[model samples]
Target: MAKTTPATRSLAHAGIAFDVHVYVYDPGAERIGMQAAEALGEDPKRVLKTLMARVDGKPVCVILPSDREIAMKKLAAAFGGKSAEMMASADAERLTGYHVGGISPFGQRRPVPAAIEVMALGEPYVFINGGQRGLQIRLDPRAAAQLLGAVSAPLVA
Candidate 1:
């Protein structure tokens, strides 16, 4: 077993079961999840990505497939907000207590409202950042929304 990340610890405490995956992390990889999909030899759709954003100026977490783009208006609407925008990388890091490429929806420094793109729900399991680069945690997608208090919505553009 590998050393537990904040993400892993959080999940364990929450009583969620998961499998950890590791791969060589290339420094300066622009799209970490896509790089993870390639390195793990998995479909890009199974690798989820976490994005931190502001819906009505309140920080929120958005989970979507690696290959998709977030639809800000739809995201805001799901949250009953007037607008939504991506948080700056620095803000994301500060709020999530992890680097931009490794921000997990679990174990955030502050618990914020979250949304999971509806498509991820159909996946039997999904890989999400495991609190650091080069690592991911595969788990049932519904756990993200059910246990993490995230609403599932059509949040991808």
Candidate 2:
């Protein structure tokens, strides 16, 4: 796998410190994040999953623990909307310019409102997708949120 990706480049450009970790990606895994966490031998809470969603029809990005599910109502409220839903996979792929399993909040083709789970921010470090399957970027969750201008909230169910 290539060591450099748009996600890594974005972090480098922003001067954020991070480490890249590569793992065996399971295409058939029902839960990508959980698979990633297991592959990395990290706690599920430390592996963040990037999700593309729509809040009142507007695109948004959400980051939360791999083991949790998003509360749609809370997600909508987080963005000051009344309703929210997961974006269509095709739309998400198009908007982020990445495949479903490889999508990363960083270096998205189109930037949008983003949120990070409040609980995740407490971790010393978290692993997020590195713009490709089988790849993750480890860094301080606080730094990731700050860099993405993501609002911190209780986003999980």
Candidate 3:
């Protein structure tokens, strides 16, 4: 796996400290995030998943733990919208310029409103996609949230 990616470059440019971890990606896994957590031998709560969603028709990015599911209503409230739904995979790929299971909040094709689950922010460190499959970036969750301008909210169900 290449050590550099748009996600890593973005963090480097911002001077945010992070570490890269590579694992065998299981494309057939039922849940990509959980697969990643198990492969990395880390707690599911410390492995965050990036999700592309729409809030009242406007695009938004959401980050939450591998073990949790986002509450759509709470997602909408987080972004001050009345409704929310996950974006189509094709749309998410186009918007983020990343394949499914490899999207990263740090370096998207376009920047959108982003939110990080409040519970995740309390973790000492969290692993997020590194803009590529099989790659993960570990960093301080608070720093990650700040760098993404992500709102901290109770997004999980």
Candidate 4:
């Protein structure tokens, strides 16, 4: 078995079922999302990435398809904020303790609100990073919503 992260350990303790996938990571690449999808042989749409953003001076997590960008205006509206801006990569790394390509919402310096777009609809499963590069965790979205205190919204445009 792969070593469990604090985040994944907590998740497992909560009885959340997940699958771990590992791959060879290319540290020099820019688009880690696409790389994750390619490595796992999963469709980009089914593989989501977590992004950190500042909304009204507070940090929020946006989970969306690996292939698309978050719609700032819609995000702001959904969260009842005036505006939203992408946080600096360095800030994200510091807050999440993971590199830009491996920002998993499950483990963070703190539990920030996770806002997902409606486009990410599916049954009970979705793919998210497993707190490291070239690693991913597949679990139920409902479990994610409950564990991470995430709110689902139609934030995708």
For model 2, residues 1-157, the per-residue Cα lDDT tens digits are 9869999999999999999999999999999999999999999999999999999999999999999999999999999999999999999999999899999999999989899999998899999999999999999999999999999999988
For candidate 4, lDDT tens digit of each residue in 1-157? 3548756876788888898888777787677787888888888887888989988878999988788778898888777999999999999998888777777888687777888766675645778888877778888777777787777887665
Regions of candidate 2 where Cα sits further than 4 Å from its true position: none
Any residue pairs clashing in model 1, and if so which? Answer: none
In terms of lDDT, model 2 sits at 0.96
- For lDDT, candidate 2 versus 4, the one ahead is 2
For model 1, the local distance difference test gives: 0.90
Write one digit per residue (lDDT tens) for candidate 3, span 32-85. Answer: 999999999999999999999999999999999999999999999999999999
TM-score of 1: 0.96
- Model 2 collision count: 0
Model 2 worst lDDT run, 10 consecutive residues? 2-11
In terms of lDDT, the poorest run of 10 residues in model 1 is 1-10
Model 3 stretches with alpha carbons more than 4 Å out: none
Q: Give residue 122's lDDT in candidate 3 (0 to 100).
A: 89
State which candidate, 3 or 4, has the greater TM-score: 3
Estimated TM-score for each candidate:
0.96, 0.99, 0.99, 0.91
Which pairs clash in model 3? none
